[model samples]
Target: MGKTTVIHHAPLVGYPDDKLYTVRVIDGVIDGIEEEVEGKYINGYDKASVEEIDLAGKEWLSPSMIDWHVHTKLAALHSNRLNLSNCQSASEVFESVKQALNDPKYDTSLERNLVGINMRNSNWTDEDLFSLEKMNELSIERPIFLLYNGYHSMWCNSLALEVGGYGSSLNHKGHLVEQEAFDMFPKLTTANNQVVDNWILQESKKAAAMGVTEIVDLEMEHNIVQWQRRYAAGNDYLRIHVGMYTPHIQDAIDLGLTSGDDVPHTDGLIKIGPYKIVTDGSLGSQTAFCHDAYPGTKDNHGIYYYPPESLSEMIETGLKHNFKFAVHAIGDYANHLTLQTISKASSKPRIGSTIEHAQLLDIEKDLPIFKDLGLIASIQPSHLVDDRDLCHKFWPGREHRAYAFKSIVDAGIPIKLGSDAPIAPMNPWEAMAVCITRAGQGDEKNPFIEAEILDLETAWKASTSNGKTRLEVGDRADLCILQSDPLKLDAAGLRAMKVNGTMLGGRWTHKTF
Candidate 1:
């Protein structure tokens, strides 16, 4: 292998192939990977006056992680908003609001439109509206929105409802479910390009620091334009795979865009990806399209957003234009219809469609269909732990059917793990830990559906790509150096991994080396 830059004597990790290698790179592409042989090494470059990174034979080199599902722009939006992620109770949520409003940094301008995220009040009874009473207590003069932990529902103040052109009587107090909330997201999250771009840039860098080098952004807006602008502004730390929202597929088609089209005004930082179609609601909102109704309600079978026939047509149309589907289906019935739609589509998506959040499954029946359709399960392991209580309260007796990660893998359907960004966190380490444990790091819920727990090796392989991890000849030189080998450590060690540095195409992105 001949190269201009050489990483000498590094203990290569990840990928099933090689263990120790001196990797050679030429202009960000791997030229050759020479395995350590005969207790010696090989240098593909001039020894003297040539720059090289010596690993000292102690550091562990791993392939950079790829998050298969994320909403890059919205992640930034959520991060910039008033964060309420760890507020376990309703009072804490209100306290957080009071604290944020009192802070001098907090802007009270009506135009600012305060919004909070990651709120979970699972202790509330089913009869509870998860009302906006607390929100209105602060002040109804300026609009405020509080998004539920699952993005399926949100509670807003009276002013927010009024401004959004919805009457207070339209929903429970000021809460909007499913379709209404999703529709409100684009309108409520208005901000100048600079603000959004800055936040996105900040979040992307943070991901690099956490060992992620690539993300498939399933943003609700026109992500192509957003990424183009961001990348043109000289922000190219993360390799973004941009997805157009389901409603905007026509816009992409009108602009003559295809699935693999490179984003304009960027140095290969962005590429077109799937068409995101959310077919069902979430368990948290009690709107997942399940075969049985929610625990308390008799006729509440949950809403299937679109008819299967129409949904299949959309899939076929996307495939006609060479776009895969990242279908969001959380319930058993939703997963059922999604599979049937993919199987019945006139043309197959080039890379095949994936069922996003394939959360719940009717194991005996769905397992075969998963294998038969050869679908890709784009799942998040963190959801299992998060949804544990929701499953108990809303989906009693069927808890085993939810977040069935191990079963999906055993059924031979390919799986890719991700944080789902704002919905979960974008840390792959956390995702791997939760997948293996079926509970969060240090969580005491006793591993919901413990039989579904995956081993560390299984979880890691599912979460990362062989292409990124393996030191194959002529592969992209994207690597991450860790202070310790992940495989050698326990679950906690993996989640608390010390990222020494990150490299993209043989160049350092986050370096402490």
Candidate 2:
């Protein structure tokens, strides 16, 4: 921690355009702020201050984005976990795997299996996890797992199944969907605590570069222990709220956990978060537990991982342990069921909950329920760009309902935005652009659900914390100093805007200054 540090003559974001202000901070907390005088700025703090970074040339300063959902480890777990994000065909996926096979870390032995991630196959002609079948192309000889882009499904070879202790439980071989993937992913990958902790820090630095100061990591394994260790090892770069997977709820209760308890001491950098429960599937996998059968599949109503009674019981039990929820729902039917279960079990409990995704919402039918219950809407706007084609293909004739951002906002619900990183880019600017433009990165001509587009102010408020005092005289100095005005920039400019610095509690986590 340092003495009073001043940011001089920077345009304060989310405010009137004509004024520039000098801001001061001390010991990781905001001290005071004063507007510029006669086209000049003066340091607000004492002249005896230890240091000052002149920001007279800086373009803008605003609160750094808070990512509501991210997978800390999956962002970049290993050097060999192939990145196939934009791949369009099955052949591209196989090529990436083959290319990654060149890494000396992986060998031909089935015991030392290979894994790849972010391959999308829904729009491909083959629509299979891999191009070849029956472990052909030598795919069967060595185990390999190609995770889908949305992480709703996982495709693995026969050797992967046998080597990972899952072959005996199944009669057939195919992509593991929803709960199977949820339960089996950690098993398939070799768990290395140190490797994962280091990976989490490296990924956090990438997020810091994007002007993000806080993130909630809802990765499906036991996250508390890993985060605790990281903080103990002095890896605190940005604030992290580690979430508990529902299967580990009892473990959390056994440990006497509360939402904001620190692990030894993280200097307020680490906190406990809500319990994450995946109650539904995703549209890309054609298993979102929809109200009607998808146009292409027969008798495919989709899958509900939780029965109502069981889900309600889980919520009630979690409430007993002072835990809130972040329930996953992608389909209309799933949302309806989630609301029903929450409504039935939510009373007499004091913790708040958010329905994650809420992608395919029946606004007219569900908005009232959400309003009456007073729940938070944790949405990922960037998913719209990636899901436009799939939404139309799988959830046909529901263009208006899919990715319904405007409807949810208009209903006056509290909105929290995130990237669902690794699933999406974790870039706040790109997320904000897609939120306001209905356009994907580098593809402005194609807009999905044009009416759902938001204004820059609203998008910024949703993407970043607007602050209780709006960065007044005294506030926590979490900020992102940029080189351009977000409101003045177009989608491309916004996406490409330069981040001069990012501050987590008045300390420069990532800074060019």
* Tens-digit per-residue lDDT, 318-431, candidate 2: 777777678889899999999988888857334357789999988899988887777878889888888888887888788899888888889976677888877887888888
Give stretches of model 1 more than 4 Å off.
1-3, 14-19, 37-44, 47-50, 109-111, 125-135, 167-173, 465-469
What shift in Å separates residue 279 of candidate 2 from its native position after superposition?
A: 0.6
Where is the poorest 10-residue window by lDDT in model 2? 127-136
Clash number for model 2? 0
Model 1, 1-513: lDDT tens digits are 333566777777763334567777777777767776654543434566445777877788777888989987778887667878688777677778878776655575423688888876566534353566766887766688888887888888888887778876676578789988988887676577887899888998899898788888888788777788888787889888788777778878987887767776677768888888889998888889999988779899787988978887788788788887788998889988887777777755556568889888888887787777667888888878777888888889998888888888788877888888888889888888887778877773568889888777777766554433345676777778888777766668887898888878767789786
TM-score of every candidate relative to the true structure: 0.93, 0.92
Error of 2 at 19 (Å): 2.1
Local distance difference test values of all predictions, in order: 0.78, 0.77
Candidate 2 lDDT score relative to the true structure:
0.77
Residue pairs with clashing backbones, model 2: none
